[model samples]
Target: MNISLKFKQVLNASLLKPLLASFFKPYCLLCVAYEGGELGLCKACLSDLPWHSAPQCPQCGLLSNGLICGSCLNLPPHFDATYSLFSYDFPLDSLMQHYKYRNMLPLASAFASLFHSYKLNGHAGIANIDLIIPMPMHRDRLKVRGFNQALELARLISKSTNINLDYSTCQRVKFTPPQASLPLKERIKNIRGAFSCQQNLHGKNIAIIDDVMTSGASLNELAKTLKEAGAAHVECWVIARTLAKSNY
Candidate 1:
């Protein structure tokens, strides 16, 4: 086997072994308090989490109870639908920053569990998805980070839902300015035409996975690219949504 495949096999074996997990419990990256349980965070932290309970815009995934948020209703996104697990605030935002920027990879799995635990109620229509595609990073950024947070979350999600995870099906051709550093309009411009599909996605229903959604520009661009590549439908699955300033 190739070196990369061998490493992946070792990592998978380590992740699957309960005894190995126990031995590394105290050092677990996501475990706020390793009390010998499998859950990374203590029950208290889990219970007090600021989960996304408000209804959201069916298009952009912004928190809203109405048919759609004003922003989305006025201007629809390329993606057909969006869903998120938590609101981007306080402890959740802090945790996400750590996971995304600080290389706390274990937190991805914890966030995935949060996404898996969410019940769609009667919205089963939105939950039945075919494939999970994480937003791809430019080659340069991927080299620096060693892993994509979105891909890590997607892996956990795939394990939970038994869904297909296609990491290399989409490629990011541009190494544009970081979306967080740019204005909303600039962010959209930066990501436009940045993504392309390498494999056939014709007639496939794809769910774009991401660590968080701020302006929704990246997801919109990706969805548009997928649609152009003959994807029948595109949905977004995100870990957190940045609430509007008025709601805060």
Candidate 2:
């Protein structure tokens, strides 16, 4: 690329883009009555969203008053910790459904922004991560979806944090029914032996990105695979976590 062209691209991204965006205010995705910010949500709507601020178990991201919950204590998941930004409810649930099923692509950027900013506050361990892996989808499912929502979110996060993102290193080998469709007892079995890691992640601390965590069976299985490949640590970083008895 020409030097001048490179400079122009940077200039547009750093200045011109924001300037143009400022002039054309976008309507809030939720209320639609107010002008939206970069998150596609107005201040009131954004503030009203269910943030996961309650004291909880750091392992499974479920509500727990103390350190590790009883479930994690009894049968620990392969992942060391979990960090979820929102409680999967109401408007958030609707927004996620739109993003994943309806292909609301811009929501990827909005979600990535949420994750990045949340981490920036005090997640010092994020800097220790060697790789960012988006929850891998089976090739068949990827084909039908046209794009992987997790991969899209991870791409923006990788760019912002300058972390190496590896989508290909781990893959969902078993093409099974959607975990959402299955019963709780069937979820772990459905996800069992689903992932395969191509590279040896020896001593690598990894963060896996996903849009929603329901049963957590999928993330647990993936973390197990990464640990088997010698990953030093694995953590789940999801946009939302279902709080009900439905899944995890």
What lDDT tens digits, residue by residue, belong to model 2 across residues 1-248?
A: 99999988886786687556655777777875547788787889888989998988888889888489888888889999999999999889999999999999988888889788875456878789889999999999989999999999999989989999999999899999999999888998889999999998999999999999998989999999999999999999999998764244
- The residue-by-residue lDDT of candidate 1 on 1-248, one tens digit each, is 99999977886795566656667664334353556235477776777777877867777766667477777766777888878788888788888999988898768767787687773333476456778899998999989988899999888888887879998889999899888898776887788799988877789888889988888888888998998888889988888888763110
lDDT, model 2, position 73: 85
What is the lDDT for 227 in model 2? 99
> Candidate 2 clashing pairs?
none
Worst 10 residues of 1 by lDDT: 27-36
Report the lDDT of model 2 for residue 111. 82
